[model samples]
Target: MISVQGLTKTYGGFRAVDDVSFVAAPGRVTGFLGPNGAGKSTTMRMMTGLTVPTSGRATIGGHAYRDIPNPGRHVGVLLDASAQHAGRTGREVLALGAGVLDLPRSRVDEMLETVSLTRQEARRRVKDYSLGMRQRLGIAHALLGDPEVLVLDEPANGLDPAGIHWMRTLLTDYARRGGTVLLSSHLLHEVEVIADDLVVIGQGRIVAQGTKTELLQSTGTVVRAVDDAALERALAEAGISSVASPDGARRTEAEARQVGEAAAHHGVVLLELRAADGAGLEELFLTLTSQTQREGAAA
Candidate 1:
């Protein structure tokens, strides 16, 4: 299991990660989610000891990442697939990692095969590999030691549909075999399909964390009307508060039926109404982090 307790990182006066805490339990896939500049990468870096935290700690199996001798054997990490040396072959890259981990050279070949890289492909220089191929190579390197925990950042960045499906199956099987998996991604749909638990971050802090079902059930409802002003007034008069959404307004207390009744009672024309229970992850993420987005400067 991976545990993060009050982990924080600061640069100058900026807080890159602020007292973030979450656990990636064994036999489960935890999706680390956030928008651009939400500090997902910073948190992952702290967990791996790649970046020292200003406070708190991240541990694997009760030991800090730096204190774990032969850490690759306990935790596999793939923070940047493109960080590999461009001149080296995929096989060479895995071979170096195996040497560092003191694993037999045969393990390198095993990992290459495990990641579906053909012998020919493994021999080619990394500079010539496609982004998907590089991602595959990176995953193979991470798994070469057969670690109990896996931390991957944007593993599906360049994958096609088939490759993405393969990754889903691979990670799912790994978790089933008792491995802890923490996958970070901005793609809500992909994470929704595979993650058992979710840790959502915004502005360097955790905004939500729970099982997929628990989080989805917590979202209220979405409603719209022909006259949005009238619908808003009706909802207000009925004591149900709502928040603005792209399509309309969403409420945490009222269900679609309740909102529809209010609209009818107030003589407001109802155009759209739906319970947000088990709503798409995209909707949940957008709603949860609406105010935390780093808006680009106007051109």
Candidate 2:
């Protein structure tokens, strides 16, 4: 299992990560999420020992990352696919990782095949590879050790829809076989589709963490009217509290039925209304992190 307790990182006077604590359990995929500058990446960096933590601890199977013997065999990390040596062939990249971890060279071929990299493509220099191909190569390098835990940051960033689906399947299969996975992504739709658990951070602190089902159940509904003020007034009259979304949509804990009835009673015209689940991952993400969002004036 992957564990982080009271993890914090500071730069100058800025607190990049603050008291972050969560666990990515064995046999489960934990989706780590946040908007830009929410500190999700900082926390992941700390967990992998890429950056020093100002305080607290991060561990894999009860041992600090630096203390683990043959650390690559214990945890696989893919923080940046593009960080690979552009001069090296995809095969060479994985071969080097295998060598570092003291794995047989056969493991490189195995991983290349596992990530769907054909022999011809693996022989090409990484500088010629597309972002998608680089991602595949990076994934192969991470898995070269056949580690029990995976920490990937935006692994699907450059993948097409089909590639993303393939990645989801691969990680899910890994977890099914008892591997731990912590996946960080801005793509909430993909995360929602595959994550067993979720950890949401904003402004250097964890805002929410729980099983996917639990988080979705707590997400409320969003409703919007041609006249937003009218909708708000109607909801107010019905004793339902709501806050306007950035786009003028209003979100509330009230169910759709209740909101509709209130609109009818107040003679208001609703432009849109949907449960949080029906609205999909975007609505839930916006609602949860709305307070921390950094908005700019109209262009």
Total clashing pairs in model 2:
0
lDDT (C-alpha) at residue 73 in model 2: 92
By summed lDDT, the worst window of 10 consecutive residues in model 2 runs over: 290-299
Clashing pairs in 2: none
Q: How much is the lDDT of residue 63 in candidate 1?
A: 96
Per-residue alpha-carbon lDDT of candidate 2 for residues 1-299, written as tens digits (9 for 90 to 100): 99999999999999999999999999999999988999988888888888999999999999999999999998999999899999999999888888899999999889998999999999999999999999999888888898999999999989999999999999999999999999999888989999999998988999778988877774567788998878877987998767676787888767899999999999999888887554455566665676677761110
Displacement of residue 109 (Cα, Å) in model 1 is: 0.9
Q: Write one digit per residue (lDDT tens) for candidate 1, span 95-130.
A: 999999999999998998888999999999999999
Q: Estimate the TM-score for candidate 1.
A: 0.86
